[model samples]
Target chain A: MDRKNIKGFLEFVYDFYKSMKAHEITLVYEGEITHQITKAFTSLTESNMAKEEESNSVQKKVFHVMVECLQNISKHADSFGSDDFLFAGRGIFMVSRGDLEYHVTTGNVIENSKIEELSKILDHINSLDKEGLKQLYKTQMREGRLSEKGGAGLGFIDIARKTGRKLEYHFLPIDEDTHFFVLTSTISRNE
Target chain B: METIKIMGTDDTPTVILDAQNEIFEISGRSLPEDVTAFYDPILQWLDEYSSSPNPKTIFTFKLVYFNTASSKLLLDILMKLEQLHEAGNNVVVHWYYPEDDEDMQEAGEEYADIVDVPFEQIGYTLS
Candidate 1:
């Protein structure tokens, strides 16, 4: 612990605290995503929202959106170029509260080959209106087959339908085989 | 057949499906990490019950919150009742929701629209 390095670390910590406070972020975690982990995050967020005096319906919406976002990472973690220990089984999850809505943001790695297909799914969901999303949701549930991992590919549509807001996302290319996918789902707080 | 009564946790719902005592209900939150595995028994129970169901089966769903995965499982359960109804059984579903919760109410309506089972959406206060 050199004096100069210790001083820099404290400054970094202080800066992070300030940024988090400014954003009104309720929870943040960067690690592996699992069922147990999702349960913990959602439970903690539920408590936090309760403290904020949110209505029961808004609390339900936020809780639902958070579960979907976290579960997506655990269920859909890409296996490309993940041999690197740092990249394998790692993800970033955060929840922030604003005046009009609560935001659930997640970041994870994805195979390059899956980018186009994934993009199309998100785009298609975002392109539709309320009724359209409802139709798609029913159709997907009735006809869609569960993946090898048991996901019926209904998370996004359900989130979109519940929140009544467009999903915001983008992929940052890390190399040729993998990209960092970041998604943010907003739940309006009018309740 | 033995009844299925599993206590609900923060993630899983409390399920009560006892045929002998005239009680059949599923309530509370549901978001198990493994939906297929957790719901397999319930589905199986419904399957077996369909074969030798009570003359008049009145199942109830009092789910407070459930994920999309569980949504599919709910449809499966409702379809079982629908099949029972089609096979000369009087099956009615009472989808219960908190009085002020539109999402839960609408959820019941959606299921009612898709399935042929007689549905009665009942709104009650959360005591």
Candidate 2:
């Protein structure tokens, strides 16, 4: 609240933004993931990619993955238990372009109780080959029931199949009862 | 029955089902937030169309992008068309993709693989 403290905080924020820019992140959004936000984000991202002269195919893949990631946060993000001031469904999402691939990253706080199930699912998906993932996607599509949140339990598998890459995920414990879940998926420019 | 026509939006596809003209088409992006709400009427229309389909029902898909939820509904629509075909109706699906988009072509192929109906993969450039 004091002048020197405010200066230090401003410098910290500047440093964070600088680091993100250095990584070639074209977009960085951190806040509540509302439906309006999702719609606007995808539209902005598509136009941004178009200006970059990315191929149509790659842009489609990036947009699809972005939708899934943003929706995942909106539907499943948990409130931080002790941090009551933080809004529910708050999450961080970013899209960065690398030399050969575009990386989509998202982070949200989740209940610690959900970590085991989430980890198991991620591990199972990561263990599959491309063919295996395709098979899984088809089978799930045919038989999986839609969740109350409208997910068909196929979002992750579809992402894996589209990217043809292992999904990278991590769970960082924020407290005894909550953890922040981060997911990263890459779409190869050559593909 | 009257034709069913729904205009496309940012998150929903344009649907044109004309029994009298024997033409059916779906175009644009389909990542609707409420997949069930957006697709229920289309499914119901298909059910009604199956009872009295045209001699040759040509279904065309020119989708730029769709999400996982829409993917499920798409398969459902295709399966309905397959049923119509199985019941001795002439059904053909024309799937169009941008010339540079191999992924869309592959998506059409995947749908073609799953159903017994005839499929045509068409690629065109946007001018």
Candidate 3:
């Protein structure tokens, strides 16, 4: 491996290990990578059963959340771009399993101009609880700006409400015109 | 102007909305690759359906599962129905959840609180 690539890899591993101090099972997908996320999703879910069978509700919610988070990576992947600088937009999707909760995090490079809008949406969704989320979601649907692409921006809020957890996020500056968007959410199995 | 039908899958729901019949049904799970594309037609169909007065509009949403994006579209559908109801059309939303799934039941109630129409949450045992 080239020195630069090796350095980046080591740094990523170090950061991931530091962040997930207590997780036993950690799956990390980096760069322009692809996999059957569903298989990993199903296996991690099945591992939850030590011997006793768990409810289908738990399985469904976990699966739903996993797929939703992974789809963000697929949706934002910039493939076939001529600019090598745009190569960093490849993204990373990671899932970490702890004894009591599951942590799902995804990071993708996005346009710097979109950072404000993304932050606003995250802040708005985080500001609401289940009831408030539903209300705000409805209101947005009624009056929010719909892109010609047809997105009204309620995906993050739904994640928060459905998982019954806070939607955590961070924006790490990558360059002049782009930033790495990292979103993390937790689902408690004990609940 | 026409009905939109999307077959169900293990990961996604079956979107069955017929503008002509004024019967909208979303069943099964929802985790489509692209949320916007998957839901646009359904939203468009509902929008067109709302323009003309349909005597009875029944929205049956029995989603075993749905991701965050699908939740957004679900709200969109409900709001469109609310607009229709406000205009004095007959609109009712039947929200079905698996028995013992309090999360789904709570989700329905939350939607009920937002929209004007009555949302009846029905539960059926999987067994």
Task: Using DockQ, give the best candidate's number.
Answer: 1
| Candidate achieving the largest TM-score | 1
In angstroms, give how far residue A81 of model 2 lies from its true place: 4.3
Cα lDDT listed for each candidate: 0.87, 0.88, 0.72
Specify the highest-lDDT model's number.
Answer: 2
Ranked by lDDT, the better of candidates 1 and 3 is 1
Local accuracy of candidate 2 as per-residue lDDT tens digits, A15-92: 988998899898889888887898998899889889989887788889889999998988789886454575677899
Tell the DockQ for candidate 3. Answer: 0.35
lDDT of 3 by residue, B1-127 (tens): 6777888976668887776766689999875655667777777777777788568888899987776556666787888889999999988899999898887887798788877896788999877
Candidate 1 docking band? medium
lDDT of 2 by residue, B36-127 (tens): 98888888999998997877888999998888888888888999999999999989999999888777887788888888899999999988
Extract clashing residue pairs from model 2. Answer: none
Q: Can you tell me the DockQ of model 1?
A: 0.65
Give the winner by TM-score: 1 or 2.
1
> Which stretches of model 2 miss by more than 4 angstroms?
A81-87
